[model samples]
Target chain A: MTTAEITVLNKSGIHARPAALIVQIAGKFSSDIHFARDEDRINAKSILGVIALGASHNTTLTIEADGPDEKEAVAALVEIFQSKFSS
Target chain B: MKVYSLLSLGEKHKENFSFKVLVHGENRNLSHATMNRPGLALTGNFQIFSNNRIQLFGKGETAFLYQEQHNPGLLVNCKKLMQEPVPCWIFTHGLFPPKAIIDLADEMKCPVFSSNLSTSLFAIRSNQILTDEFAPRGVVHGVLVDIFGVGILLTGKSGIGKSETALELIQRGHRLVADDAIEIKSIKGGNILLGAGIRKEVAHFMEIRGLGIINIPHLFGTGAVRESKVIQLIVYLEEWTDTTTFDRLGIERHYKQLLDVTVPFRKIPVRIGRNIAIIVEVAAMNARLDNMGYNATRDLDDTMKRYMEKNK
Candidate 1:
């Protein structure tokens, strides 16, 4: 499993649009995508699971993916986070 | 959306979005303290000070006064200035701040500063610098489409047809907010989520299977889309794998992080003849229902519990 950490820069944190985007990207791979914040752990491809975490701006979150494309997924998602979801 | 209103305002002002502030520039002697504070003011204009080293921030219009120089008369005037007190200060580096301005800033109870570059360079560079520091520019691959008044974000593999599905949703009377990469911003209170696609020159338009790159705004008209929307739902598109288990019931909610907020989510598997667009739209409606306190999964669970009790 490849793990990555991101700092939330969105004013509302990790709300709907962004969570959905993450799930969408995670779904592209053959890997098992998981994200955790605080004490919550969830499938990164599941919108409901991600939203339940209630992550907000500047919140540090962790993501893990395990599979053939685990490395790629981790790298891309980390890049996305570093891009503040904009790029 | 509500989430977007919280983020610091973008420089290219949009009429739909507005901000106000009282701006007063002062030349002053550089102070070590006024190096890099940035935030908002009481009336709304973002404040910055350039003593030629660092930039500071004041978050909002109602923020407090921050300064660099230590001048007593100005300090007294600022303390007695009346009205609302401003918060935050941006100090420029390299440029020498005039003493009078420094005193005025101190008296006005405003934050002061220096810039790392010369005045003209600071003016040009400050915008970029501040934007880099304060703008919420997080982006993600998403298809933003409106369904029944709710903005839905569809995400998944490259071939999962997130864009195609969004196109269909638009044809079905839903509006498109963005395609491919969606830029999102979180506004104050961390609730409103605003999103928009990159400019047309950089939009990539979108080419789907069986269809070439189509100009969505051209075909659908401007009404078919919004410049941005609050992201409320996340629908993940996945290709079915024999080893993977999919959700049989629409109960379990999934989530992903962007900056800090958590949004409700659903996982929709992509398969032949699934009418992915319809499913996505339904998911959006269902999410809206959940927001309205009507949860299908919870209701079913309650019903099942009742049935067991009755049978027992």
Candidate 2:
């Protein structure tokens, strides 16, 4: 599996709102997105799962995709991080 | 609660949402509700901007406001809207506060809340995550080559020929973790010391005698090396002299402190063609054996004591 890391930049941290937004974005992609904090891994599309991570802002999250569209999913997530979640 | 059902104005205000809101609360439920609830679920063209503020671009009249605090300026701005058709309120991190900003938000009827974290730390952490910009954790140590499955750390002075010995170890079917400066991190189990890989500019590549800057990885297959390894033992390379007393038996294992944990240590005397790599490898095996409940030094001491008792 290929993995990509993104640092959260929103002023509100990865609280419910940004996490919900991230979940929404992940839901749109066909590939399965798993986020890792240290050793804990959870489904990125799950709202409660992501929130349970308690991933505050600036925390580095590793996103792993294993399916066919893994590369594209990683690329898209990188773009979102680069843009600072403006869209 | 003076419910002034005022209309929003057409002219938009420019406000920066860069400052983080610190909502210090004794309870968890209030804290959770304050940050998760949507501020403005309006049906209008919106432009999300930096600093967590949104700029709405549309032509609507009578923008209804739904918030807890009442600000005269915000009310006045909304009252002047000629084509305001949506009601919106910006979400904050506090439920209620007793400060100048809270008073202002109250006067404007905007909600003020309390957060669990400090404002500055929250902002910095948030920015770091969204941006994917992180600085790798670093450390200071001397990483030597690996023998069998043991990672050996060579320590001494600058001119102790540590690098030269590591190169020799690599030539003997071992792997080099790092040279000169080695970065280590404790991961997973207790006191696991992992050495970092050498940078691309100076990888597999070693500075040695006869040959200069040779790439070992290129010459040998991937199995011939590892970029990093769990440091199992440390070998202190000392100058060779007849007077020097080395560890004749392995009863007591020497330890060196790093970060917070201590690693097993061995002192090796450096002389001409002493086969230091083999000895270091043997030291590592001995340490491993010690871990597996076998102490050669102690066993030899016990044997000698028994022999003396019998003779007596």
Candidate 3:
């Protein structure tokens, strides 16, 4: 499993669009990916689960993935958050 | 096999059904789930008689006893009926037994009860209680919730979010039946499975990962919890893995066996962004639709097939 602590940098936080971008990237990989916020660690590939987290701007989350391509999957998701979720 | 005692019958129905104890039997245990009227036995017919059941003395038997008040053979038949070592006797519809019959019951050390409830009502109520006592029961580690009047049992390994998902469902106005440990019973010979909280009073309490043991009724009010429910569907939440395959089409029905009863089943893959509560809600609604004899997946498939045939 690959784990990385990342902070939400976008002004709007990890809203629908940013969540969708994370899913788009996470979907390409075969690894099982999850994003943890405090007591909740939800599937990164699931848009609603992420949005339900209410992870607003500057919220710190832990992204973890396990499977054959865990490293690549985590890196891709981490990049999405660090890049300010740019379209 | 559970023993349905005559003592339980009187105590349980005493308040609501006005069951009054006239005499206490030497044998307080009842061996049958069904109550039988001893009209045939009272007529001096002991052939193929069930001597181990609760003898119900309704209006017909009481009327016969009155009608045979002057007959010498009447005393003999009544004595024979009371000596069968039967579990107990109940006189219904406010009819007090004849003094002679009560003396015979007292002498035989037989328990006797009288109730103002109609004979049929008493029979039905006794049957319900005895059936519950004799039904097969089991305990399952899951959460039972009532969604849209449908009882759904959420099952999976520990930390798979069964409680968390159930908590969300409760927040959505659904009632929780049992959390963590659900006591289930196969009713009607395993045709229907009824689920309740393990200890009953503690069934509404839930344990969320970080939130210790929280009482659902206290947190969400009385409307958020139910004492028991008939399990209509079972949803298994499995941790999503790369190689695992999930039911995408939902065209074919899947089932989970609970106490030898089969219930419609679904295995939902747990994903980070997936709103499992919504999925569970939809699954419950779909189960309700399925119970109503409608399958959206099959219906849409049939529509597509007909459309293709027309094009052909």
Candidate 4:
């Protein structure tokens, strides 16, 4: 398992478009990735699951992935969060 | 629990205990899960009183408060009780607190509620709601379906056909409780595992591989869906392997624990030609039969033993 944390820096937070970007990035790897906010743990590959996190601006989210490419998957997700889903 | 949310649960059923909010607090939380009568505490005996609990003023307490209305101090005990951080005050039997008391409660920023149910009845119903609200809950990646009135949870790796099997069951007149991610709560003191969808807005909706999001109720009507159900059985759908071992007989029961509740469990191998829907249905029926004290495998073993003894 690999884990990393990132705060929602964008003023818009993880709305529909950002959630879609997360899901898209998460789908690139075979690892089982999930993002947890508070007590809620949502599958990152599912758009609805990402939206269900209900994360708003400044909410810190922990990304966890478990598989052969766990470390790479976690790094990929952190880069996306740090980029604020811009690219 | 949010006191506002608690109000919604208490007044959900009009017949059980119809509650009316006399004063709404600042969306405060109910600090405690239990209720208190405030019987002795009304007389200034503050000795073992739980100020965090919601105080219920029953007939006796109401009458006592009314009689104290004539006192020169103007019911100081009520004022004293309200001064504490009591989450709220509930008056039963359609009784209303004196205007003085209500004003005092309003000044203290304590919520006040009234219900038409008798004291004991309201207490019982609210306690039941509180117990459920405070129960432990968890979220599982699975699809819960009701077949033959049995709640069967299908769980496995993503894209392993849990949703596909559930769709087939729904086609066969079974009900879909939740799909993808099922939110489960254990109630009845951890004896019952109640399952529901993550949210009501997204319930009865499924995400298919190629079809995207589809509404079951819209596709199959309201009869094909249910809000929630007790998870009676769990089935894990996995890829088939030549060397994998499977349970041939239902003699030994397998259990899967959810929120501290044990539910009958089974693992079914998935293959191209195999019909997982029918297998799940049969599993549910078998569970129902087991509940009726009948075990086909055990019965067969006993019959075989009897025949061998007679021949010997």
- Which has the greatest DockQ? 4
TM-score, per-candidate, Cα-based: 0.51, 0.44, 0.71, 0.89
Q: In the order shown, what is each candidate's alpha-carbon RMSD?
A: 14.1, 22.0, 15.6, 2.9
Provide per-model DockQ scores.
Answer: 0.04, 0.01, 0.02, 0.39
Compose the digit string of candidate 4's lDDT tens values, residues B1-312: 434344455456545668788877544556566899898888778898898888999899888878764664546777778764677888998899878877777887777889998988888887777778788877787899999999999998777898889999999999999886678999977899999887766668887778877889999999999999999999999999999988888687799888889998899999999999999999899888999999999999999999999999
**What lDDT tens digits, residue by residue, belong to model 1 across residues B1-312?**
011111232223322222222234332222221233223222233344222323333222112333324434433433333223222244333333346545555566544433344434444554443343343446566677778888777888656778778888888988887666566765543465666664434243554656545767788787777776778887888997788798787676688666676776777878888898888877877777888889887898999999999999
Candidate 2: residue B285 lDDT (0-100): 73
List the candidate 3 regions with Cα displacement exceeding 4 Å: A1-87, B25-27, B66-80, B83-85, B188-190, B306-312
Winner on TM-score between 3 and 4 is 4
Q: For candidate 2, lDDT tens digit of each residue in A1-87?
A: 779888887765666566666767877777777887764566675544555566666889899987778888888777776677778
Candidate 2 chain B, poorest ten consecutive residues by summed lDDT: B28-37
User: Candidate 1, what DockQ?
Assistant: 0.04
Model 3 C-alpha RMSD to native: 15.6
For A1-87, candidate 3 gives per-residue lDDT tens digits of 999999988888876688668867988898878777654456675444555556888889998899999998988888778889876
Off by over 4 Å in 1: A1-87, B1-135, B200-204
Q: Which window of ten consecutive residues has the lowest lDDT sum in model 4 chain B?
A: B1-10
What lDDT would each prediction earn against the true structure?
0.60, 0.54, 0.80, 0.83
CAPRI quality of model 3: incorrect
